[model samples]
Target: MRDLHNRISSPSAARRVTGILAAALLCATALAVPVTAAAATTTGTSDDATPQLANGLALTPPMGFNNWNSTNCRAEFNETMVEGIADIFVNKGLKAAGYQYVNLDDCWALPQRDSDGKLVPDPVRFPHGIKAVAAYVHAKGLKLGIYTSAGTKTCNDAGFPGALGHEYSDAQQFADWGVDYLKYDNCNNQGVDAVQRYTTMRDALAAASKSTGRPIVYSICEWGSNSPWTWASDVGNLWRTTGDISDNWSSMLSIFKQNAPLAPYAGPGHWNDPDMLEVGNGGMTDTEYRSHFSLWSIMAAPLLIGSDLRSATQATYDIIGNRDVIAVDQDSLGKQGTVVSSVDGRWVISKELADGSRAVVLFNETGRPQHIATTASAVGLPGRSAYKLRDLWQHKNYNTAGAVSATVPAHGTVLYRVSADRHWASYPPAVEAGVSEAPLVEAGTPVPLTTTVTNLGRTPAISGSVALGGPQGWRVKATSPTRTAALSTGRKLTTSWTVTAPAGTASGAYDLTLTAAYRSPTGDAARSELATIAYVVVPPPDGTSYVSDLTWMSATNGWGPVEKDTSVGESAAGDGHPITIGGTVYAKGLGAHALSTIEYYAGARCDTFSAQVGVDDEKGANGTVAFQVWADDALVASTGVLTNAEPAQALTADLTRAKTFRLVVTDGGDGGDSDHADWADAKITCAA
Candidate 1:
């Protein structure tokens, strides 16, 4: 569904400072909504009454690929892409790992229906027609899914025909074309009741299935606005419990917090979907992607791949293709995980498996390493003296004396499959090790790095040693005692090292590895490794310079890649036009959408930052946004609310002795529909 239209702001200039202060207060506290035990499990719902679809499909949450998040409505979302995905699923290990469906999202149909009241596939996109594409997918032993809305038109701005009044005909058409799945969206519904609208399609699909003997999996994509999870259990196989998902930690974490509480609503045939997967998207790090996948699996959500599989990396495949994690999602118990305990930002979630076992996750949401600990009894397990722990990511087995703990990295998750089998003497020690965040430093500067190792096993780890390794041409020396005495169970050893990069090292992110080695009580050697990143920044320029000319330490956008000197376009890089604000084009600036942040290395040399900011004209009179400038973590300046109806407004901030400078743009209390923002004539003045 699209966002509501913008509300105009007061033209009073005095409200600018007040708005800035208010927004700063909101930014400081709004995003820290905590997950608690009170909302962990569902109440008032009897387990015996959980609704199920009689169709018998989706006995477990469906695992498959959807081409919406990566190539939504783009030219590349054609017959070739769909067939290629099926090929990859067959050739790669995905098919063997239980991923079956190959789905296509919106814009697959022509803008207008045929004269005979039938839908037509876009000839340019599917030259061979829909039936031929379905045949190709079926030949590869995979099912095919198609997308449409229940309204008069689809969600995309192109206004493709929907299945509103034509449900029976459209259902028959899809069944005749061999379509195995249908993702029905909610858009432009013209104020109709949600239950009535979805039920109409449900009956239509059932009738079509009875006539044609072909069952199509129904996915209700009402975006949780109507609380689909509470009633759509019999109407659809899976229903989205949240809005669309972006490829960022904040977005993923927010969705997880929203979906994790609805555990009781998910079952074998009906599920609570949280949009789609964004594993291979470049917006977040690999560690964060792993956490995303783990949380989704523990929730028993649908495992739909949302990336371009033809161009994905090995790391993406490794995270999504983990059969161990997939098994947890497909467990016969059909139970979603609930939060066992949550303190500060560390969360412990556990799900009961069908085989008298538990799937536990130690999730860290903070920006630093944390020691998250739980117990077998707390996670709803049998009170065994010892348990067999299998690390899902590491794919290793260990023994623990009822303690389920780990030093989880920032935005990382430690998943374990715990069984009550007591094989403690045969397994090695379970040591959870991680390093702290490396400080941002200039080239040739020495910085201290720390690593902490903890023993969570039944026996002690003997002769433990920790080492930190840096990139090539860098020097690493231990600053503290590297060797430790016998670390008893639940004990920790912290070590530090001083590292210096070469003088000529370029400014960018560099990789670092922290290794911890120890021996079990039986004198068996074991090693644990954690990978981290360090930043090397260049000094600020000596004179006034355009901000778009300097290198930024980090940049994150809402829709697509941050443009250098153009407006924020769709998902592709460099697809934007010139930086235009209210029809006035600027020569140099940074262009980004709302919910964006760009960080620069001010290096304490920058004094003044100034820019003319407004909603970009590329989106016409359709956007509303606000801009803010931060020196270090303090808000130095802000634009109250600039809309596409208004001209550019000047903004300046004092950056005295501030090491980091941040540029932020947010949707002005509305949603981020067309909020294309620009920092026109953005410049930084520094001391020479």
Candidate 2:
């Protein structure tokens, strides 16, 4: 169970075999066990037998709280803690807040089951039996969730009286004990396809749940292996999407950020588990905890709190119980957040709500603070309409009448819920200016000059002075912004400068903040898009003719270029193995810098050349390359270079199309390296 959150790259050895053989064998074996259970109502092929049953449990996002983070098998389970936590839920009014399930994680089961092959509760610890404990939990108007595994032993090495061979009987026992939820884990289940194994347990639980007239929620505990998102609907109500999250901001942010891309897979019933909430775990501050809550909500993951409820402080209650923030998580539309933009390790994620509002999060994963400006369009909101924004965490409202931008704090997040409004023209205009390309001084190479700026507003942007600013020592004269003082509305202005790159301005892209701030006709001030200029400073160029691994040539003793050459003749395009040129090469016609058949028959002499080559210029005819044969300065036979842009099939040395000829290449200097006049895999066809 401890590995419950550990990420797995592939299925355990056991799961792979099970995926191959379990379907045909499982039912044959389960039926022979003489277990009376309900048959699957939703019929499908054997591999998908449990789909309907699994879907039934995951029909809605699984909502609840888990107890592993706050207390990790501390041997501290007792009626007092359980009841206290349950009482706290009622007192803090969280049950009505949509936090219902109170699950007891690992370490609750006794060492063995009864003679009838049923899991037995430890009499010393649970004097009233598990049934009575479950009843007490139910009496408090909450459901009970228990933990088990698919192996021969529990995560704690407790005898696995509830797995594999005992699947049916154990399921019946759990139903009889009033269990409402089952967390089928992947721990200790070696050499089995966890997917099918977990599915088997789910089917068993479904059978038992049907028999006892109870609907049990089944959870798959495989940590992101095989990317359960693609198969979660067939597995269980919820699936763990990442490794275990710890009680630290780094661990929490890392896990949350990883889940941002996985939001599309999360919807009603199925959820992405970001491990568990570490709010009251005594490791992070209240602000960090708020961020944790905000990110998880935006990701649309389950809100299974992992902190100790009984000992949680007032601040913990406020962070977790904030209804305004929770509204974003419980959004009826169920769309998860997405990373809209990223820079310098910082990311901006946005989620759309059912009311057509949007939730935006600016997360700075780095150590230092950064000034980040994002438009509504960047977060899926079009500027055709404006919106009123509410900072959910700050509990304040903002007027984003036109375009909105914020200077995000360090290692923090700004969560906003924006609603579209018609009165967008009332707010002041925000002016922004940035570099088209951050000027990079390649110690010797000249930089490409270009600049662009967009209004990004419903209205046009007024003209202003856009300047490039950088730290003192590394500025380039040619890389400076032009001295334009005025720009027309919604139009952009471009200018250029020339500066010599110093010896050491670093070797990577440097930031050049482009500022274009100005005053409106009403004497009010504004700014443009905070543009980024990339200044690439490289060391002196290495002027050697070094060949690249992907380069290919069309001449004798030539290699193919990957970026230019697609394929030779009908040989198709790709990285063909290695072509060795150690003999005289002959060409029948000019090649279009594609894969042409260049041949040296198995045992033919080099002088008797009979190689057929074809060029495929897939992009309609333009600058076609013609083959020219030269024996140190003598022109041999030459065919009118074909300029048709159609792809050519493998050309054989048939007399009608090709005659006995030698030497091959594109005409002229072959258009230099810029013009692809190279050959790949020239081969001579033989009557094999």
Candidate 3:
């Protein structure tokens, strides 16, 4: 049977780099490259420094098996399993399906390198040198790939043949072993500049690639820090856009949505990798795997198999090797997917393929399922003539004569490939144009604002996250989808958030930056420009302003010996008077229940005001504290009091001018229970 093996770099090189850094070193060795000395750009340059296949091998979506998902190093690289996949790729029609690379994940390294500082393969597992293993795999027309890290140690605790400072040596070692692919991971080390760190390894890979005269694919594995999209092309052929992806839907979608904004940088020879696919990992359903493959194809991400393909189910094979979908991803035009619309926890992403065809995905990330629909016009397609739409997963074609609508299951998706009819001339207007902003208010104000996003793209943007920044900590206190939303093109959607300012928050005009990001089903992502608007936080008015005590004044108030449910006093009126709530009373209520309060006031323009109370309960817990405010007269009649629960964790709300405020004993009391409550530090500075 034909065989393939992924080789780690020489041990001596790994040791020097590992010990020198005293930390984990992530590194990689490009496979099958031509050894040549050519100046490569390491800095951010617009010049065409694209990588090309050096050896006879051509870049055809390097496919193969990865060991990280199925089994750890608990078992040596299962030689039988490795050989079995190679056989299947050949005999079971996989090679014809364009599957070529057979790579090993982490954990195949011995504890130490040879005397010459070269990596020693685990003799127990391979018995044969890596060269012999490569021969077996090559005989079957398949290439080999291996793994390493930028840190001192491989993620699987293999030998720490450091690549951080020894990238060139490690690359040379892999070249000597006839290596073909490299997956470089960043796991350990602190304060290391990511760009410089990865750039060093990239340079080494290029050097080794030239030294061995073999073409190798450099796969970078960073947990998507500082935005790989900004520099992925300049660094490595492919870069992981997120942390390790699990074999579940959540992890996959999380990574997918996270990569949405990085789509524009992906193209031939350079790809955005969202980690390996866990298609046959028994974690997600077949439907999920289909969605996974569909979205990845649209994004133009590198297609690397992470699960054991030797024993994969038929369903998994069908989904992973779908030809029609693969064509969209490998389109010669090299057009990757771009986000078009997102809303209510769902997204619409569209890809313009080289065939003059468009692939669109409607994704839902919310808890419940949803239905999304848009006409050809909405997706920026000409409607003069009808077009043929095909469902990639369903393997069926439909004539989208009018609108395109489909029911999306929760955490599910719908993918479509549409081909335009040349006969069509002018059609209905598509999508919407322009962006609008909701009303803006000052920071620190107890107010919430909603922003509506309208789509104007040629296609809908798939699932993505929307972030709005104003003053620091200015977050979406409340939003419809809460986490993320998937919206369709031409659709108008709104997301809301509350405004809260932390203590010592400076007053200044800040830009409200809104960003909607998502990856193409092809794996490329486009992060829209940062939407901006200026808003100011005006300081509180200074004066003897009336305040509220809604914090504790709203609760039932009563003196000692009061029953658990006693109403001692009626809510007092503000009457344009700043009422100071003081004098605490213990509760005789049963169980651990304690005091409660309710208060209302107005005109109090203070941000800081606190009251202290002392409680004496032999068996009761600590006394509780609360801070709040209630609307007064006119405001009260309209909106009423907004009471905050007791047990004030932080002195947040203002109680400077409380209307009718009093503390009632709430806990550590029964008919015979006895306790005392005292209050002090009752003051409010409404003087601005």
The TM-scores, one per candidate, come to 0.82, 0.56, 0.56
Q: lDDT scores for all predictions?
A: 0.82, 0.55, 0.53
Question: Where in model 1 is the C-alpha error above 4 Å?
Answer: 1-53, 69-84, 107-116, 120-136, 156-159, 246-264, 281-285, 339-349, 362-386, 401-411, 541-549, 564-567, 570-589, 602-671, 677-688
* Model 1 lDDT per residue over 1-688, tens place: 2222111121211122232233323323323444344533432234775443568889899999999888878899999999999999999889999999999888898999889999999999999999999999999999999998888887677779989999999999999999999999876666567788888998899999999998999999876666666678868999887667788775677568667767767888889898789999877899999999999999999999998899999999999999999999999999989878777779999999999899999999755567788988889887876788899999988778888887777678999999887666677778877676645768899887777888878888889998888888898888788888788877889888887889989998787888889988888888777766678898778989999999998777767778998887756889888998877899899999876788898888889999999998877665778999989768899988788999999999999999889998876754434678999999999986
lDDT of 3 by residue, 1-688 (tens): 0000011133422222232122111110111121122312224754575443223232334556677677657574655566667787898776787778787766656766678776777777666866667777788999878788786665544445546766777888777777788888765533367778787877777788777787677887765544555566776777766555656554466557656655556666677777777787776666668778878878887677777776788888888778777776667666567767676666788888766677888776542335566656666676644666666765655443545555455456778787775422122212211123322344546456565444433344456555566655654465464233554544655667665555445443344556556543344554533333333334334643222212221222222121221212111221111111222232321111123333322234554443333332221332232223232311111111111222212122344443222232322211111112222233345554
Estimate the lDDT of model 3. 0.53
- Candidate 2 TM-score, C-alpha based: 0.56
lDDT value for candidate 1?
0.82
For each of the candidates, give the backbone clash count: 0, 52, 96
**Angstrom error at residue 430, model 3:** 20
Candidate 1 local lDDT, residue 549: 97
Which wins on TM-score, candidate 1 or candidate 3?
Answer: 1
In model 3, which runs have C-alpha deviations exceeding 4 angstroms?
1-43, 46-61, 158-160, 189-192, 422-688
- C-alpha lDDT (0 to 100) for residue 4 of candidate 3: 7
Residue range with the least summed lDDT across 10 consecutive positions in model 2? 544-553
